[model samples]
Target: MNKEDLLKKYFRQSLSEEEEKEFTLLLESDHDFKALYEEYSNLNLAFKSHEAEELKAFLTSIDEQEGVKKIIWYKSSTFYYLVAAVLIIALCLPFLLKPSASSLYNEFYEVYPNVEQPVVRGSEETNTYNAFKAYEASNYSLATKAFEELLQTNSNPNYKFYFAMSLLNDGKFDQALNTLKDLEDLKFSYTDETLWYMSLILIKQEQPLKATSKLELLDKLGSSFKSKERKVLLQKLQDN
Candidate 1:
């Protein structure tokens, strides 16, 4: 099925296991699909909120009017037009709220998952294993220390990338930026991801111009990594 059908199935919670996997792959790799999903998700929230507000208003109006008198009023054609107006407002609500850069960053930024060395149950207790375990468990301090030690003997770009992520998660923004900058210079396997994270860090640091520069470069590179999001974020930054 197409992404729209997959998303509809997802919202209905009717996707089969295989379809669920396909949906996840599209969400991960297809930036346009991810953007569309986010838009729909936000619209869903707006609709739910609008429904709750309308229900509460209806109850309030009922309580204010004579017993069951206003109930008949709601059956009028005017009431249907009011409902249409409310639905239109609900559809427009998400677009009406202009989010700030930091809010956008928070909305878009997710911690990079440990795809390099996934920790398995009953694995051997090596330092690398421990590092990944700590990282996976959100123990950034231990993960940072372990990855730092691992870096002493190994120069893997993957190690450096996750080490930066650990430091970033531990609130070491400057260190993370430096590490990502180094990785960016290296143009390693995670170059696209490095630029993406760097842009996020810059956004967090309130450096919109620098962040835009990174995103613009990423755009020019034509990398698939968050391509649609990069464009959206860049536009938001420029508009701000």
Candidate 2:
């Protein structure tokens, strides 16, 4: 592959081991390529930030392409649209092929057969997840409505965490704190998430000692929570 392709692989987190090494070496030796990569990174970040239905439809089309080999073209009125979608998907394929929510849920929760099965199909879980996808894209307005609707019916911990985040991002500080406290009470697993968000809330409330206390609880749960984050929280608390 050319340096352009290798640089894209680096950005997409899809670089093969050899490609990564070469990309690093090139980064050490090249300036123009790095500048090009910075531009691509900015454009990709902007694409991710936009919350239009067209972008969502384009992503859905790419998701539909996962197992296909040859993509077909339609020579109809929508040909330009189809071509645009195809190129966007081709460009984003590497970055977009992340493991699914189920995979991430399993990895993080590691719930046992002996334990309660996740309410994956429940109306609450599904609605909360829909809100979370919006919240993940920083669309706080829609996320606020979705999460509030879920909160009215669901007391699920993971849902509450994301809901709290949706509220917090919108500067609804008191509501976020209340949600975090409720989630802390209901938490069965992912206590680190509970603690982490609680830390943020306490910090917002100007309660540094309480925030550090939350970080301490997070550390007790272990390092699925970033060690760096724990250290930084500690340092911040100390500085405060």
Candidate 3:
């Protein structure tokens, strides 16, 4: 194939094992070949290691942690993982800039995570928790009402997180975006889930610049959510 085709295949990630092996042998041949390989190799590394969305989320998350210049070691590690999660999401679906956070979160549910059924509560909390659970189940309208009520009661930040997310699943796009933007202002424990959802919301809100900003940090902090997700997100960032 021509150089252009090769680059195209590489971008598509459609390289066959035999083609890869032949390419590897070509790399071993001489300085000129090595140089050519290096160019692509470096580009591939950048594609794999760079993540703009993760960076955007990190900056958004850290800015809210206004109490201390430095967090405890554990939160620091958590921060590290959060960056990883951003890259993972980006990598899995290159050019999926407009995907709903709900879709990605569903993939997460299928992974090693166990289902945590929320406990039933008083009227508003009950409705909120139920709405969140419905959101998890991919039910939108019920969750929207539940989350809206939960937001009014102001019981817990965690619930609020779900409330905002439910609004998204329900197609209350404007409301969901507004809720998440408010969450960005308040300092809460930044879960990968929260950031992932927030990133999707940003994209839906037509904020590619913000998404690219997060990708930078996530690329640096690798192996989060799972290695594949990290690699894919990193690739997307670099490729873009």
Instruction: Please write out the lDDT profile of model 1 over residues 129-237, one tens digit for every residue.
Output: 9999999999999999999999999999989999999999998989999999889977777889899999999988888899989998887888899877887888888
Candidate 2 positional error at 73, Å: 78
- Cα lDDT of all candidates, in order? 0.90, 0.67, 0.59
C-alpha lDDT of candidate 2 relative to the true structure: 0.67
**How high is each candidate's TM-score?**
0.58, 0.43, 0.43
**After superposing candidate 3, which stretches have Cα over 4 Å from the reference?**
1-125, 185-190, 217-223, 226-231
RMSD of each: 34.4, 32.6, 33.2
Residue runs of model 1 more than 4 Å from their true location after superposition? 1-98
Q: Write the per-residue lDDT of candidate 3 for residues 154-201, one digit (tens) a residue.
A: 656666667766666666767866676666645565444455555555
Candidate order by decreasing TM-score: 1, 2, 3
lDDT of 2 by residue, 121-150 (tens): 544656756776567567877888987888
TM-score (C-alpha, index-matched) for candidate 3: 0.43
* Residue pairs with clashing backbones, model 1: none
Q: Best candidate per lDDT, number? A: 1
Q: Alpha carbon lDDT of residue 10, candidate 2? A: 81
